[model samples]
Target chain A: MNNPASKRKPYQRELPVDWWLKHAFYTKYMIREGTSIAITIYSCILAWGLLRLSQGPEAWQGWLDALQHPIAILFHIIALGLALYHTVTWFDLAPKAADIWLKGKKLDDKFIVIGHYAGFVLASLAALIIITL
Target chain B: MSHTDSTKLKRSHEPVFWGLFGAGGMLTAFLTPVMILITGILVPLAIISPEALSYERVHGFATSWYGAAILLVLIALPLWHTLHRIFHGLHDIGVKRGRDWQQVICYGAAFAVSVFVFTLLLQML
Candidate 1:
C-alpha cells in the first residue's frame, strides 16, 4: 500500500455547518450580507411595478393598493430594517474598497464614510425636490 | 517573480463581480432606506400622498428616457449586488454543492430581470 503511486495525502476536512455560528463577527458579517434579501424583494416589487405600468392605470393602481395592504406593509417594514442594516454595513465597508491617495498620503477612512453620507444627503434632497415639484 | 512570470499568472474574474457589488453597495447605502421610507412609511402614513407616486405620473416618468435610465440603474445594480452576496454567501455557509451553478442562478436571475425591466420599459415608450 506504500507504493509511490499509492502515496495518500491526508483528507482535508470540509468546513463545519456551524462555522459562522462559532464566531460573533462571522455571524454579524453573514447577517449584513444576507440583508440583500430585502434588496432583492424591493427590486422584484419595482420590476413588477414596471410591468404594471405597461398594462394601464388600473393595473398600476392595483399594484399600489397591494403595497398598501397589511401584509405588504408588514413585509416592507421588515425590508426597511434589512435595508437599514445593509446601508450601515455598506457604509462601514466602503473605505476598504476605495483607495484614494491625496497628496502622497492615504486618505482617511472617516473622510470616505463622511463623504458617502454627505453625498447621500445631497442626492436624497435633490430627489425629494424633484419629486415634490 | 519576473514580469513575464507575473504576466502568465491569470487573475481571478472576481474584481468585475466585486466592482458591481461595490457600486451596488454604494447605491444601496444611499437609496434603499430612503425608498423604503418613501414607499413604506410616507405613502402609507399619507404624509406623502399616494398621488406623488401614482400610476400616471410614474408611468410618465418611465416613458421619458432619463426616467427610464434612473429606474434601470436603481433596480439593476442592487440586484447584481444582492446576487453577488448570495453567491458568495453560499460558500461562506458551507454549501458544498456546485458554486458555478449557484453563480449562474444568482446573477443570471438578476440579469434576466434587468432585461425584462428594460424591454417592458422600452415598450411603454
Candidate 2:
C-alpha cells in the first residue's frame, strides 16, 4: 500500500524582513503590536514587585528604590508613549467589537469610541486619586 | 461511514484565550498609562512623593482581599493581552519556526506569573 498524501507543495509569499518599514500603514500596525513588549515588561516589573512585597519590608523597599533609577525612569517614559499608542489603536477599533444599537438604528461608532475615551479618563483619575489618598 | 459520523461539534479553545485577551486589552488601555505615570514617572520623580508608594502603605493594601485582587489583576491580566500579541507579532516579523512552542511559551509565561502572584497574595493574606 502506497500513501500519496506526502506530495503536496504550498505556495508561500515572499515577505521581506523590512516589509513593515516600507509603508506608513504597515509601520503603524507593527508599532501598535510592538507596544506589547513594553506592556509585558511592565507586567514583569509589577510581578517582581509583588514578589518583593511578599518578602519583608526591606525587600519591598529595595524594589521601590530601584524604580528611582534613571534607566527605569527612561524605560517608563518610552513605555508610556507606546502604551498610549496602544490605547489609540485599540479605541479606534472598539466600535467593531461593540455593536450597540439604539432603537432600530445602530449606535454611532463615534459615540462608542468617545465613551471608551471618557471611561479611560475617569478610570485613570480614579486610580490616581485612590493611590494618592 | 456516513452513519458513523457524529453530529457533535469539536470545540475550539480559542474563545477562552480570546476572552482573556479582550479583557486584558481593555484593562491595559484604560489603566496602564496612569499606572506607569504614577509608579514609573511621577513617584520616582518625587513629584507625587515616594512616600505615596511607601512600603507600609503598599503592604497594607496587599493584605486586604480587594487590594490583593486589584494587584493580581493589574500585574497579571495584561500579560494575557501582551503575550498574545507578542506571539502573533513573532509571526508577523517572520518567525516561521516552532509555531506550537511559540504559543505554549507565550501563554505559559502569562499563566506562570499569574499563579506566582496569586500564591504570594494568598501567603500575604
Candidate 3:
C-alpha cells in the first residue's frame, strides 16, 4: 500500500552526510582530524627516539641518521603544519569552552584569543632565546 | 506579529548560544596566524639544531611548564570544540537520540587526555 506519509516530508529531516563537510565547522573539523593523525605518527617517531636513547649513544645517532633522510624531513614538515593548525584551533576554542566574566560583564572572545596568542608568542620567544644561547 | 509568531521568533533566536559559537569561531581565527608563525619558524630551526634531534632536548621542551601549558591548551580546546561541533553534526544527520552518549564520550575523552597529559607533566617536573 502506498502511504501518504512516505511522500510527505518528515517533521525532522536528517541532513545529508556531506552537509557537515560543506560548513566552516567541517573545515575546522577536517583540520583537527588531520592533526590528530599527524600527532599519532609524530608520537611514534618520538617513541622511537626514546627507545634509541635507551639503547646507547651509537643507537641514538643511528636514529638521528634515519631522521635526516629527505623523506623523514618531509614528513616532519607535514606533521609540523598539522600540529600548528591543531594548536591555533585549540586556542580559538578556549574562550568558547569557558566564558570569562568581569564585574558582571562577559569578555569578548577576540580578547581571549588575542591574549592566548600573545602569551604563546612571548613564551616561545623566551624559550628560543634560552635555547639559542 | 501574532503571539504565535512572536513565540516562534523568540525560540529561533537564542542570543547566548549564537554568541558563544560565534565568539569561539572568531577567537580561533585570530590565533591561527601566530600558531603558523611559531611552527613555521621553529620546525626549521629544530631540523638544523643538533640538540633538537636529541630525545632529551625534545622531551625537555615538551615537558617544560611552558611546553606543558601549550600542549594542554592546544589539545584541550580544539578537541572540546570539535566534539561540540561533532555533536551538532550528528544531530543534523538524524542521530538525535544519543546526544547524552556523545557528551559522555567527548567530555570523558577530554578529561582522560587532560589527566594523562598532566600526569606526564608532573612526572617530568
The candidate scoring highest on DockQ is 2
Model 3, span B1-125: residue lDDT tens? 46665467544533643554354344333443333333334444453366644556646666678976765555444444444455565565566666779768755654565565566556655
Error of 1 at A129 (Å): 3.1
Error of 3 at A126 (Å): 3.1
Candidate number achieving the greatest TM-score relative to the actual structure: 2
Candidate 2 local lDDT, B19-102, one digit each (tens): 999999999999999999999999988889788998889999999999999999999999999999999999999999888899
All models, DockQ values? 0.70, 0.85, 0.11
Q: What is the TM-score of each candidate against the true structure?
A: 0.88, 0.94, 0.51
| Poorest 10 consecutive residues by lDDT, candidate 3 chain A | A38-47
Supply candidate 2's per-residue lDDT for A87.
95
Fnat for each predicted structure, in order = 0.72, 0.88, 0.03
Q: Is candidate 2 or candidate 3 better by TM-score?
A: 2
Chain A only: TM-score per candidate: 0.82, 0.92, 0.77
Worst 10 residues of 2 chain A by lDDT: A1-10
Q: Model 2 off-target regions past 4 Å? A: A1-8, B1-9
Error of 3 at A11 (Å): 15
How well docked is model 1, in DockQ terms?
0.70
